[model samples]
Target: MVFLKVAPMKGVMRFGKKGKLSLRFVGPFEILEKIGDLAYQVALPPALSGVHNVFHVSMLRKYILNISHILNYESLDLREDLTYEESPIKILEKPDKELKKKKITLVKVLGRSHAVKVAIWEHEDEMRAK
Candidate 1:
């Protein structure tokens, strides 16, 4: 559910083990922009995959559900409020010159909340480097 007054939240998540693929979001989510069915720029975790990375079954389902739930739940303050763009079904691997410098080909999401952002960490090295 959406909070009228932004709630405190934080954390990070990585799509891979090496911390090569990632997205970060700091929340105190103040409804950035809202369209009919899509909420663009709503506060989300850091390290959100675009739509190209290969994900494991469990990881994929979890991330999709988490985003879905957040978008589906009603807002506490607003009458009818749900925020989300789309499910993370296809996580694409992007090349980060910064990460490549560290000899790391991974992405990481960092913030404050762990339980909320855990699903993003599904694609680990052992399961993905195939």
Candidate 2:
């Protein structure tokens, strides 16, 4: 079993509106064949048929599945659309800046996962208005 490494921004967009902040690695997919010295063809699900199954070695990580350990580990429930729902936990910081005649207020949000180092910033006024 191997895990696929997806870009953080792309993964967030694909996961959901709020994004599955903790769900970085999406699969433990089986390797179909070796494409080259640095790449391998993987067996992807039908939902990901549009994406090429071949992936570079750097994008894959080995998954060690232990039956006893699996009981304590929670797997993400991927939807039919290959997305999961999540939300921001709180606002870590609120800062304001003056740009000419307008003032923009930005809020640094803490997402569901503690592993997220980069905070998601949103326009406070826009978010509040919405």
What TM-score, to 2 decimals, does candidate 1 have? 0.17
Off by over 4 Å in 2: 10-12, 17-22, 69-130
Per-model TM values vs. the true structure:
0.17, 0.47
lDDT of model 2, residue 109: 79
* Model 2 Cα shift for residue 115 (angstroms): 30
lDDT (10s digit) by residue, model 1, range 1-130: 1322212234444432223333332223333454444333344434533432222222211122254545433323323455333223334453344543464344332322322322233333532553
lDDT of 1 at 126: 30
- Give candidate 2's error at residue 8 in angstroms: 0.8
Which regions of candidate 1 fall more than 4 Å away from where they truly are? 1-88, 97-101, 107-130
Per-residue error for 1 in candidate 1, Å, reads: 17
- Best model number under lDDT: 2
lDDT of 2 at 127: 59
